[model samples]
Target: MSQIPMFRESFQHASKELLHWFPGHMAKGLRVMQQKLRSMDGIIEVHDARIPFSGRNPLFEDRLASVRPHLFVLNKIDLADMSRKDEIVSRLKYEGVTEVILTNLKNGQDKASKEIVSKMIDMIKSGTRFDRAMTSPSSYNLLVIGIPNVGKSSLINRIRTVHTKREGKAAPVGAEPGVTRAVQQGILVNIKPKVYILDSPGIAQPRVNNVVEGMKLALCNIIHDHKVGIDIVADFLLFYMNKAADFRYVKAFNLDNPTDKIMEVLVKIAVDQNIYHKVKPVTGGPWMEKLNLEQAAYFMVRKFRSGELGKICLDSDQLPTHTTATLSRQRARSR
Candidate 1:
């Protein structure tokens, strides 16, 4: 429940109605973000530690290569699979990112933030000192980039200690998934060279096949938005849990006969949660109507990343095509 995004009404409806509705706005935002990125000395690339690959932006990678050096930040380590932290760390390093820093950026602890800042300084002084010398009045600039809802704004708020900014004045940082649709700067003064952190919009992965698959990759749990039960999420978790952990998840939930069909599994969960009201809709009355069980199961497995499920990595792998991929393959055949 705590993992649920804020402003539940809008998110719930948006999740249900427009989960796959990514428009040109993201492409437009990416262009703007790249334009703004030219000023920064390095990128503080944020990814969900749990799903690093999915959060990466290939466009950002290509665009930023010429602009600045990058510090790949694997954030939200607190919520990640404790057992696999070393493996995740190793995997990221293997992915051509040597300066990976594990952090719980949203919680705003000073120790982690300070270490992040220190790491940035060390990297800059080593490789970016000559670049810094060229600017007339250069301040230390770091581009904070990530996918939507990956805790970028929350991290900024914690670092600066300033809350919402006033109208027509410099705004205090706030946390919305895509809050910084256009890039904005936040100043942190403690560092010797003043730190100018560029907060950018969350970047969307390029559609691999069609928009629907892209939606599934970006928003996640698209089926849960349209459906009432957590069955899809459960099935997804069960499917991946077994893959990642090398054992099925049915034993944890105690479902003797596990079905691959999400709806079938959801019915079992409804019975287990003891809130399944047959007289009412399958959504389980008003209280559970908006509940997203698929997301819930993902959250539980996320809480304990024991590798019992299959390697359930969402991002940081091959870009997924899903429905969009299927459509693209079909189009290619026709061509």
Candidate 2:
């Protein structure tokens, strides 16, 4: 079966804001997340394959450190580079995360993925060298978390293969943030039923709490907020796409000159595709290239996300060295 298309909802500022939560709801959710963390033999931490770091719940690891033996679920592998995904899984394992599962939940029935999940669940039940539960067939609770628009619900739907209320509307997919407001649970059963996974609401990183983090998120998405213009967001994407496309690809497109400016490369693509509109200058010097580069970048990301870019993954190998301490310092200055 063909892979299901992923749905995305933009939560550009939700991560930074104190997410509006009723006192009772906040207390209840935390109690549930913590309670589930305790009784369960193992935890499954789900993240988007594209932006793994950004998709991480900033507060989750610390909250569940005591609940040892968690599986790192990297979903949407189809949108990322296979080699880079391998490298990331290895790096994460080296960084104290032992059990990692790579899956393109869009195509859940794929046999290899089923085997990976089975083996990982077996390992989770078997107990790891560092795990506290070395002698038991304990119940497992998988906590599926990620940034907004990373296909959490779609994955759940695929795994369960049914349309339920928690899955929401069926015909038209949502493209806005917080579609899955509360936590929902589902059972994963094949041959023997033994694992449960929770789909949590998308948690976004707050707006450019710092300039650098802000830029990273903006580069990935064409964000629109009072603080930044659509042009700047578009410009950032253009820069990254040009930097990412191989030299051979660039030369094939007849863009042989070396320039760090993303706008220049975009201009070349616009001209080559004949996407430019000619507007005569009153001074009669020349007709300016009328194509909007920002729109081009937006479409490029859309194409990339939709897999029309031919399995291309952008900037997946580089790891950001920004530490929590550095982020905290930058946040303090912003305050």
User: What lDDT score belongs to each candidate, Candidate 1 first?
Assistant: 0.52, 0.51
Lowest lDDT block of 10, candidate 2: 1-10
**How many clashes in candidate 1?**
23
Writing each residue's lDDT as its tens digit, candidate 2 over 1-335 gives 12222322222323332222122333345446676665555555666576665445555576664355666767667866554466677777766677777778657465534554465566665655435545444444556655555666666555444322234432122444456565665455322344566666655543334443454444434122223444445444444444443222244335554344557756776777666656788989877869866555554445555654444344352554446774464334322
Q: In model 2, what is the error at residue 29, expressed in angstroms?
A: 5.8
What digit string (tens of lDDT, one per residue) describes model 1 on residues 1-335? 01211211111212332333344556777777677665667777777665766446667667764456678876666655434456566766676676777677545344665566667767766774445555433467777877666667666655555222212223234433455566665555334456767677676564334322333343343122233233333444444433222233455454554334445455455456653322345656553343444554544433344333323344422333336554464334322
RMSD of each candidate relative to the true structure: 11.4, 11.6
TM-score of each: 0.64, 0.61
- Count of steric clashes across candidates, in order: 23, 3
In model 2, pairs of residues that clash are 15-204, 15-206, 16-206
**Candidate 2: where is the Cα deviation over 4 Å?**
1-32, 39-41, 65-68, 84-86, 128-140, 162-177, 185-191, 206-213, 218-230, 244-294, 310-335
Candidate 1 similarity to native, TM-score = 0.64
